[model samples]
Each structure stands twice: as structure tokens, then as C-alpha cells.
Target: MPSRTLSAMDDHDPLTKAISPPPDETAAEKEARVKSELEAKRVSDAIDDDIDKQRIAEKRGPKPVRVLLLGQSESGKSTTLKNFQLMQDAKAFRKERSSWRALIQLNLVRSIHIILDAIARDYYPSSRPLMKDPNSSSTSPSVSPPSHAMPLPKETYLDPELLELRLRLDPLWKVQEQLARRLMIHESQWKEGLHGGREVVVNSAVAWKDVFTKKMANKRESSDSGRINWDDPTDPGRVLHECAEDMKRLWKHPLVQNLLEKQNLRLEEMAGFFLDEIDEITSEYYIPTNDHILKARLKTLGVSEHRVELNAGGGLGRDWRIYDVGGHRSLVTTWVPYFDNVDAIIFLAPISAFDQVLEEAPKVNRLEDSVMLWSSIVSNKLLERTDIILFLNKCDIMKTKLSSGIRLKDYVVSYGNRPNDFDSAASYLKKKFAGIMKEDSPLPRTFYCHLTTVTDTLSTQKVITSIKDMLMRDNLKHSTLLL
Candidate 1:
């Protein structure tokens, strides 16, 4: 009994000493101190009460459907997210349309700049290499140039008119840099001689849309007519409009086309391609269409979370949260935290990238990387219960490449003797991915696969609807099981 009393006394000593009033306190001082302590305790107790209420509410509420979009860079993850927003929250998606103008403009300018860079390379055949080979080593045998970097034809010659156009369009590079810097892109992210000299990358945490939105707001505030000052000298749109003719000529010139062909530079097949729509895009008051926004190539650097309420179909009123993570090799490590408690993962493997290598890891085949990533994902115990949906994305591009006689067997050597047609190629690759899932998964799970061209709004929306139905059904099943 004495030991129990001493233990209780010891437990209270420090707290009591800390809270006790001074020994020499007056009557009024003691009252004030007591009131102050009471007020603090009241606040602390209220906070605890609110926290407990919140916990209870969370336990009673319907959990939001959580999905993770996983893929390498340029695999259409962002486009898929845009489609979701478009379908579920059309009003909100349209509200951000104006803000996408600057990004689309940047995309157009970057494409123009790439063509210019290709022209420059042809002109300066003996000039120093534009990019260092990431895979090259001093002791190893010489590596061949990447498939995209085909050797310039010996007889290639630039038209003098093309040179004049290049000179006129030189100022647009500054505009590209300006727009890129405004979006928080840094020097390190800018890869010169890579994909037409430089690529624009922004962290998902950066509210890049808000940057342009605020700029437009400020423009409105400054304008007398309450409209954007199109004549603003700093506006990239103005410069793009001014050089629109030259951009068209440069893109259309016969020699320029020949040069691009020799180098295997198919800008149309590339993301953020706008050269074909030069006139409409460079108009004085151009607005991006839904297709343009989806096609715009702004590489995401980190993880981005998007939340929307499902307003239609079986999932009405249910909240959905979609996470888009950076798919670059270096950024893949950041995807681990999001794997926990995720309801589904949409893994995009661009079958069209069979002929290409990763921009970050120059030697790694992109398709192979996708397969490896899939294997790692399925094998992880953390994602054992997570529904894995495989999107053989860029089916359109794959079709085009196959039609152009770019043999899949040439790249995927194990695909030997298979029909080089789109269906055959897509099926083979899909089966290969399915095989990996079956063999490597920690636990058996249903394999959901889709051949998706996420850019096509109608088809993608249909696919998304089906996916929503599936997820909603599964969610209800789990909730019922818990009951």
C-alpha cells in the first residue's frame, strides 16, 4: 500500500510542480493564474473533443475511392486525369481552360524550337554533340546513337529561305525559356539537345495553373476594357502570333521535312505537337480546345493529387481521389508512400515506346522499363490487395508506327515471327504484361487490361465509365463484407 502511494505520488510530482503557482503569490495573482490555467485547459480539452469527434465521423463516413496513375514520362497519365476531370466535373475543367493557354503556347513553341534545333544540327554537322551519352563509358566499346538521333544524310542541304526563317524564329526560343521559367522550371530540368533542345518540367506541388490564372487576373485589373491586353510586350502569345507565318513555313519547307525524315524526327507522333495547327494556335486570341489541353506535354516532376465527386452513374455522390505520380526513373521512389491503402493502380505501358529509350536512362528501353516496373509493382506485398489495371496506352501511336513499317520485332526481339500488325503487337505485349502479373504477384488478383488511347475523349470516357462501375462494385462489396 505504501509503495503504491509513493508510485502515484512520483507520477504526479513533475506535472504538479510545473502547473503549481508560485509560493509567494498574492490572492489576486493566484486567482489570475488559476483562471489562465483553466482557460488553457479548456482549450486543450476542446481540441481533444473535436479530434475525437472527427475520428468518429471519419469511421462512420463513406471512404473516398482512391486510385493511383502509374506510368513512365509521356505515357498519357496527365491526359487520363484530365479526362476524369472532364467527365466528372466538366464545369470545373472548363474553368481552367483559359489557364492552359500559356502551356499550349509553350508546347507549340517547344515543337518549333525542336525543328530549328534539328536544322541547326544538319547545318553544323561537325559541331560538338548536343547531348552527352548517359550510357557511354571510356573503357566500353562505342555505343550507337539513339534511334531518334539518326545520322544526317551526306547530301543534306538547308534552303537559304529556311535559314532566314530560322533567324526570324530565333527570338521564340527566348519566349520558350521565359514561359518555362515562369512555370518554375529550372536549368537542371532543361535538357539541351534533348527532344529538340529543351524540355519543360514542373513539380506537381507548384500551382502552375494558378500562376497563369493570377497573371490573367492582374491583366484584367490593369486593363481599361476589362480584357487581356493582347498588345502586352511581355506576352508570349504576341510573339507566337508574330512568328506564326515563319513557323508554318519552317515546318512545311521541303528541305526541312527531308532533314527531319533523315533524322527520324516525327514531331507529329511526339507529345505537345502543335506545328500542324500553327495557324489556329498562334491566332491573336487563341483558346485551347479540350484536345489541345490533353495533348499538351507538360512533364510532371512529383506527385499530384486530384479530387472529384462522381456526379453520374452507379458512383453518384461518391468522392474519388486520383494520384498522378512522376514516372521518371529517378522519381519512381516517391511512389511508395502512395501505394499504401490505395484502392486501385492504373499502370500505363506505352507499347509505342518499344523503339525508344528512356530520356533519363539513355540505355534503358522504355517498354522493357515498363515491364520491369510492372513486375516490381505486382511483386510488392504492400500492393497485394490493390487492384492493378494495365493500360497499353498510345495504341494510336503504336498503330501509326506499325503502319509506317517500324517492325516491332526489330526492337522486341523476342517478338520474333509475330505479325507486325497493331492487334497482334498489342495482344502479344498485353499477354507478356499479364504473364508478369501472374508470376510475380504476392497474391492472386484479377488482371484488368485495356488498350487505351487516352487522348480520344469519347472512347476513353467509355473506358473510364466501365472502370468506375468496377471500382464502385468492388467498394460496395468490401463495405458489405466489413458489415
Candidate 2:
């Protein structure tokens, strides 16, 4: 008991005795103890592995906030989708640029068809009775709606040189027909979110059969050419050259202008299919520019979802999905599936449509339809909490349409003739839309809006950036996945 070591003293401690190793025993007993210790370690490691897996699963698959592009047909929703591609998925946009060549050609051909239709309508009237104006109270079958009728342009005719030129370029029309039929087939076969048919056409489609084919060259340089030249000097260049003079003449002719005026058609927005640039647009190796693609209108058939992993600013590596749907009334029924988890909705209202009629419903004024549609969306219980961003799109077109004497008061009675300018008309539309938004939403929903010509990428990009910033702030405010 003179100087006891610490171990010797601890040997007598109750706690030490409780945790002490077992006394030396038989070999079988030692082996059994070893087995039990190994088994415990194995069980502990398995628990750790399960915990690591749970953490990895949580970090791996973060849900993407859905954003929907919503509007009536021709309201610029798809164009906005293309802009997102251009901004977020530029490589993809460039990859698809060649494919868009066929679409641009189709748009030009569509203009030609529109002119032809106008000419036919003027000379050869339809047997089916024309629809009466919904605003009018007249019951007489013979009563005409001259007020709504598009203004007639100066007279034009198929003269000698024009007729000869038209005959020369007749094959182009056939190619146009082929493109149209392909689009019809593709669209008819499409359902919601499945664009396999679109890709099918993209794979097999040519700009214009017999007129041109893909000429091997640096794609960037090929896309910028403003001449009737191809890297591969094929036959189409000669065709465009032969009719270049006549093409210019055809575009400027009062007759064509008359047709455009009569039909209230603006082919310029569709790649601005200028007759002066016939040589360029109809080139054998034509590649559509971004602006051209912006102007390119492909009638949407179903919902197209584009997933963009934003570079920075917006939680890097985070998924920003932009959706574009066929804004037509019939296709709207497909929009319900998307409503379940939407974080935002970019609603496009073509302010220019104030005096126009819905393509689906001929008698319904476009603005009225837009208001009703807006009311339905903003008031929808399903979407009450979703961020609703209004884009009064086509401000450019609205300006031109207003300048052309398309009166807002004529279509929207509430407009009341308080200056038929862009500001007044746009303000009127904004008020109409704002009235529909739910003021009492529990989420403190804020209304974000912009007057946009989405085709103008410069301005639209600014708006997009603002939206991106706002979204980041909102996420931080609510502590939603903001890195």
C-alpha cells in the first residue's frame, strides 16, 4: 500500500471493473468474443453507410421550379422559348440553327401563300357566307362589315414580266407545299410534351428540295452571308439570281402591297421576307440568323419544356426550366397537368391583337379572349400561389398596327377613344389584365410585368436578367434553394 500505480488502484474502481476485459478463458471462449466484437463493428459500419446514403440522396436530386409560358396563339410564347435557348442554351441554338433554315423558308412560303390567298379572295369570293361582326346588331345577310375590313392597298396585277417571273419561281411553291404538309403531319401526330415528330422532320427536312442542299463550310461564316452565294455553287443561286430583279419588283408592286393591306398581313415579322433580299434569303446555302429565327413562327402544337442549367447568379448548376405551349384554346386543356407545381407563369398578351379576332374563334375579339383567359388563370385556385408575370408582348407590332389605323376603341369598347397611341392602348390592356390578378393571395404575390418585343433580344435579355434577379431574391426571402 506504499505507492499504488494508477492501474492497480483503478482495478478496484467499480466503473473500471464494470468495463474490464474478461478473465483469460478457453480458446473457444476467446474466439466467440472475437466474433461478437467483429459483428458489432460490422453492424456499426452498416448504420454509417445507411446515413451517408440518406445524405447523398438529399443532395443529389433537387427539384426544379417550373416556369410556364402561357398565352393565346400567336402571342409570342414560343418566341420567348427560343430566346431562352439563345441565352441559356446557345450551343443548342446553334446546333438547331440549320434545322431552322427549313422553318424560315416555310415562313417565307407562307407569306407567298397569304398573298395568293388575298388575291384569290379579292377576285374569287368564297361560297360560304362570311361571318358577321360580333359587335354589330345587323341581321341582314347582305350587310357588310366594312369597318372591320382591312384597308385595300393600291392596285396590282399579274403583268407580263411579273407573270413570267412567277412561272420561273413556281417550283419554290411546291417545295413550300411539301414543307407545309410535313408540318401538318408532324403537328397532327404530336401530343403534350412529345416533340419526337418535330425532331423527325428536322432530321429529314431540307430548306427547299431541288433548290438547295447543305454545302460544307464553316457554319459560322455560312450563316452570316448576305448574298446569293453558297459554299457549294449549286443551282438555287442561279434560280434566285434569274428572278432577283422580278422578286424586288414583285415585293414593291402596288398589287402585292394591296394584297398585304387587304389581308392585314405583315410578312416582315416572319423573317421579314423582303423581296429586295430575295437573293440572300433564297440562296442555296442560306443559314438563318438569330433575328430571322426570332421572326420565325412555327405554330406550336403542344407543350415544349426546355431545361436550362443557368450558368451563375441563379444557384449555379440549378435547373431553370422554361415551358412553351400551344397557346390556342383547344391546346389549353393540356395546360392543367403543368399547373400542379409551377413556380411562375410568363403570360404573353399580344397588345396588337386588340382589333384582331382569335383564329380559333372567328367572332371573339382577341383582346376580350385574352382578358377572359387572364381572369381564368390569375383567379385559378390551383395557381393562386404561383408567381404570375405578365408580358404585354408584340409592342412593336402594336405600334405599327395602331399607326395603320386599327382603332382600339373599335374592338375594345372600353378603350373609349382616349388617344389611339401606344401608351394609351398598352395602358388600357395593362389595366384589363391587372384587374384579373388576385389581390388577396396569401402568398403576398407580386405582379411583375414588362412591355416586350421578344424578338428584340437586347431588350428581352434585360427583362430576363431582371426576372432572374427577382427570382433569386424571392428564393432567398423564402429560403428556397438559393445558394
Per-model TM-score versus the true fold: 0.79, 0.68
Candidate 2 C-alpha lDDT tens digits along 1-483:
599556754537878777666787678988888899899999999999999985685578775657888888778886787777667655544544544665666555445444544444564454111223365344322121211132223363445554554555455543543444433333222122110011112211222222222332233224333222345333333444455565566677787687677766665543234444566677656767788777776554666667777666432456667777674675674575556477788888887777677765778987778777777777677776678889998899889888878788887787785898899888777776776674534445677889999989888877877777777787423326454
RMSD of each: 10.7, 20.4
Best by TM-score: 1
Candidate number with greatest lDDT = 1
Q: Write the per-residue lDDT of candidate 1 for residues 1-483, one digit (tens) a residue.
A: 555445644656867888778889999998998898899999999999999985786588777777899888888899999888887755544545555777788778777767766776767665433444455454432222221233345576656697578677767755765575445455555544355556656678888776656666665523122244566668788888899999888889998899899987888878888889999998998867888888988886888899877775523556678999974765774575556787788888888999888878879999999998888888888888788898999999899999989999999999999998999998899889999999999888888999999999889988888787676566433332121
Flag regions of model 1 displaced more than 4 Å.
Answer: 1-59, 126-157, 181-189, 221-233, 313-315, 475-483
lDDT of each: 0.75, 0.61
